[model samples]
Target: MAVDLNEFKHPSWITAAGAITGYLLILIVLTVALFIVPWLVFLAL
Candidate 1:
């Protein structure tokens, strides 16, 4: 199957927004997992 990058292009603003949103989501999840899991484990101990 052939994929075309041009066919997938959105408006520059939309593309930028999507990239920023994806990055924020990754950071939020990482922060929660890194801090929250250890705290929960300590509470259980």
Candidate 2:
């Protein structure tokens, strides 16, 4: 499956902002999980 960008329109500022916000949200969730999961496992032991 090849990605074709020939017909893709350039993203506006709003689209760019949305993508950035989404990325940040994902990073934050992963970071929180990474930090909290260790403690959770330790507590369960």
Candidate 3:
């Protein structure tokens, strides 16, 4: 299925906030998987 860009338009700040939140969420997940989890596992072993 394809997404429609022009449907249900929102304010610009709302769109910006959503994009930033998504970006930050991706960073946080990568950091945890690549760094934090490895550190914890190293300490455990």
Candidate 4:
């Protein structure tokens, strides 16, 4: 499949902000999982 690069043109700051937001979201999910999973495991035992 051919992708068009022109369609992706945007300001550099916008892209950087998106990347930082994505990273923070991933960290939040991992932090929540770290707390929740152990509680679930303890409950299951």
Q: lDDT value for candidate 1?
A: 0.90
Count of clashes, each model: 0, 0, 0, 0
Candidate ranking under lDDT, highest first, comes to 3, 1, 4, 2
Per-residue lDDT value at 6 in model 2: 56
lDDT of each: 0.90, 0.84, 0.92, 0.88
* lDDT digits (tens) for residues 1-45 of candidate 3: 999877647688679889999999999999999999999999999
lDDT by residue (1-45, candidate 2, tens digit) is 999775455567669888999999999999879988888988999
**What are the TM-scores, per candidate, against the unseen true structure?**
0.70, 0.57, 0.70, 0.57
1-45 in candidate 4: lDDT tens per residue?
A: 999887667688679889999999999999889998889999999
> lDDT score of model 2?
0.84
Model 4 score (lDDT): 0.88
Two-way TM-score contest, 1 vs 4, winner: 1
Model 1 lDDT-worst window of ten: 4-13
Error of 1 at 18 (Å): 0.3
How high is the lDDT of residue 10 in model 4? 67
lDDT of 3 at 1: 100
Report the alpha-carbon TM-score of model 3 versus the true structure.
0.70
